[model samples]
Target: MLKVCHMTSVHKRYDGRILKKECVSLVNAGYDVTLIVTDNKEDEIYRGVKITSIDFHPKNRLDRILNSKKRMLKKALNIDADVYHFHDPELIPVGIILHNKGKKVIYDSHEDFVQDIKEKVWIPNCIRIVLSFLFKYYEKISAKNFDMIITVTPHIVDKFLNYHRNVHMITNYPVVNFEDRKNNKRSDCNQICFTGLISPLWEHENIIKALNIMKKDDISYTLAGPSDEDYIKKLKDLDVNKRIKYMGVVDAIGVDIIQTHSVAGMAILKYSQTVGGKIGTLGNTKIFEYMYSQIPVICSDFVLWKEIIDKWKCGICVNPNDIDSISKAITFLKNNKLEAKTMGENGRRAVIQEYNWETQEKKLLALYAQIAGERVL
Candidate 1:
């Protein structure tokens, strides 16, 4: 078996795409897979992927960026794997180092960095433009040295095509077990849920505010994910806290547990989408997750999302920016439980047929096969 090592300086050891999905998938496909991450200091194995944990507790964001890359490079040099796949943008320089050592280096572009930089709320508005420009050019120059570039979306692949020679678009889809399709059959729960990142950039605040306007006092909510301490505190202050149950940080199983008892999902992802024309096209991971879990989604009515929702008849596409529209969508799902249950079943069917990780898994296996000079599956 060909040895493959995936390194991530920015993300967690169990990042869904990089580690859990990519590394775990590779392991099942008969590769000698290993993962290196910055979070955990103690090394261990879970789900067949061997993890090489590094101790790097940084004081601040800058320390993690600058220090993690340096530490990552030092540890990466000794791995000596046939292929080194890295996910962090900050690890671009390290990729070049591995390439020079006659190792196949793959850069996984997780996001459109240009747009991400523009949407970075922490970065000062004045310098964001300049930083975005410089980062784009820098990535372009660094990516040229890598063997292949694996991007999360087609839109992101376009951004790298001119810069990198070998690039592939691999959409991140939720891993749904079609065997347990019966479990996904929806029933009325009088509850709604939101899973994953709860941030202002993702318009999480809109969903919270909309709940206030909702007429249904009996409805409770479950928020299952990590959040900034300050922002979490702000949420605690909201009067809706009595109805909204915050599950702090939940694992995949925990999310499933929440979804099992939930009726609807709120997916208001609008980061880098505030512009009038730039509506999301590729779709968010949470949307697919909600679909697979057989939860009717109440999400932003972007053009692309509307196209998919209309075709699938899976869920309601609402104006996320307006609290009234969000509340109305919630009420519609609540008052009409049978309709909501049917919509949830439609969503699960959509996932089984077209939107599950199985399709993307084939693409990933084919890519790795090509890299290893093996016959494409």
Candidate 2:
């Protein structure tokens, strides 16, 4: 069996994309996979993938770049696997080092780092510009050394293609299994749901503020997944009649429950074209999850995202920043339950037919095949 080592300095060991999808898929495909992550601990096996660690969690952003990089690199070198896959922008140098040791290094680009840096609110305006330029150059220079580049969306692929030829577009689509949820009908549910990174990048506040605009006592909102402690406090202080409830960090089944119970899903990424802003147009996994759960969606009005929503006819794409648009969409979905139900079914059908992880699985295995010399590179 080919030994594969996946590394991450940021996300936890069982992160959805790294563990649930990629590592698990590799194991099913007959590769011996091991994931290297932070938190120095003994290695163990979870779902046939070995999990190892560096036992390091930095206090701040600066520590991750200034300190965690070296320690994680040392752990990676000690693993000595045939193929090294790393996630995290700061690990670009780590990937290069492994590549120099003659290992097939694959860089997983999940986000546009340069864009993210451009939108970082904490960084000084002058410094943010400098950091964005430095990171843009560094990302390109480091990515060119990798054997292959695995990207989560076409947008990221477009960015990476300018740097490297071997770019694989493997989206972070949900594990499309809607058979069990087919018979589970929920017609009049008034709950709206959102799970995943509940941060400013995801426009968490936008979702809450939209709900605030629609003063419907009957409607309730459920949010799961971890967010900053300070942000959590801020949301708690919102006088939204205690209708907005945060369920804290939830597991896979927990997230599914929220989606199933919700009448409509919220995926309102903030509309921003600034340098470090979040890529609002990429594949938002939560939308697909809501579809798989058979529900209408209220998402941002980005051109790429609107096109998908229009093609599927499953939800309303609104100006996320426009309180009236979001409020109107939700109010419509709540009042016109039948229309919302139809939209939900259309979304589920779309997920079952095309936007499923199983389809992306083929792309992933094909990339590994090329790596293993089982197919032409």
Candidate 3:
């Protein structure tokens, strides 16, 4: 029997986008898999898969790095597996160690680490630059050593094409057959929704400002996600509390419900150096979720997003930084419900026909087969 070990340093649980679906697919394919992740305190079996959580504080910067490195390296050394699959960049050193031990390793690049570092405000610019450079250099070196490198985007794959021979793009798409009941219901109120980590990159301030400008009493904005106290305070100070509701961190099912009740979804990310690269990238699960829920989307007016919105007629594109533009987009969607509904339906159709988990999973399985030197199933 083939055995695979998967590692993640920062995930709250083993069951998230890439890891969860990948684990389920691999287990169904007759692979014996063991996932080593940061313990979220509640331990349980998920579809006959074994998950071993190592105690680590993901919030504590130094502890997260050190503990993840120690735990992953030790676990990789002890596990008798055919392949070692690593998800987090913090586990690169551990992957290197596992490679030296003659174990086949897979490095899954979830994002462009070099570009991502620029968004981190805690790290000094100089430090971020040095670390980004080091990360790229080591990533290239590590890719050569690993059996295969898996990435979420084709652009990311392009970055590695010159450096690595075995690079594949397995996008993060949502499972096709989720609860479809909510899609049929339209809320009486014109509610605009945004669901994601409440970070500076998300640009929630503009959304709040837009709400203040629109002054449309029938419409209210719901910002769902856990946020830092300072950021939350800033949101409160916007004087749109009556128009804005803060529904702290909703899980997958909860997010589905939220999206169902809203008129449209917002992916209004600021075009900072760090976020510019991520703005128009397709295959983000949220985009599919919004589409699947049959709600139009008001996204940042990036070239990439314009292509998608124009191609699918799924939603409107607006300047994320401009409060008036965002407010106008929301107002337009509200005033023209029929058009918005059509855009949403078109998006859902696109997702069902081309961009869902079923399509992406095949890429993943094929990539693994190629790495294992087996014929494509």
The regions of model 3 sitting more than 4 angstroms off are: 40-43, 178-183, 251-253, 275-279, 374-377
**How many clashes does each candidate structure show, in the order listed?**
0, 8, 0
Candidate 2: 10-residue stretch with minimal lDDT: 274-283
Each prediction's TM-score versus the true structure: 0.91, 0.91, 0.92
Question: Regarding TM-score, does 1 or 3 come out ahead?
Answer: 3
Off by over 4 Å in 1: 184-188, 216-218, 236-242, 251-253, 271-277, 281-283, 374-377
Q: Write the per-residue lDDT of candidate 2 for residues 1-377, one digit (tens) a residue.
A: 78899999888887889999999999999998999888766778989999987878778777877888788788777777888888888888888888888889899878777877878888898999999999888888887689999887667787889979999888878886545657446675878888878887666676677778777596887889888888888876773777778899998788777787777999887766531233454545877888888889898777766777899999999876787788788889989888888999999888898888899889998888889883123
| Candidate 2 segments whose C-alpha is farther than 4 A from its true place | 178-181, 215-218, 240-242, 273-279, 374-377
Clashes of 1: 0
Q: What is candidate 2's TM-score against the reference?
A: 0.91
lDDT to native, each model: 0.80, 0.81, 0.77
On TM-score, the stronger of 2 and 3 is: 3
What tens-digit string does per-residue lDDT give for candidate 1 at 1-377? Answer: 88998998878887888877888889999999989999756898979998987678778889888788877888787777888999888888889988998888899877777767877778998789899889878887888788789886556676688877789978778887767845554455878898888876556677778777665575777888878888877766673646678889987789888887887888876636322234564535877888888879887777767777999998998776887888788888888888988888888899899987888889999989988993222
CA lDDT, candidate 3, residue 76 = 60
Q: Give the per-residue lDDT digits (tens) of candidate 3, residues 117-169.
A: 86577899999888888888877777777878888766677788989888888
Cα deviation of 131, candidate 1, in Å: 1.3
RMSD to native, candidate 3 = 2.6
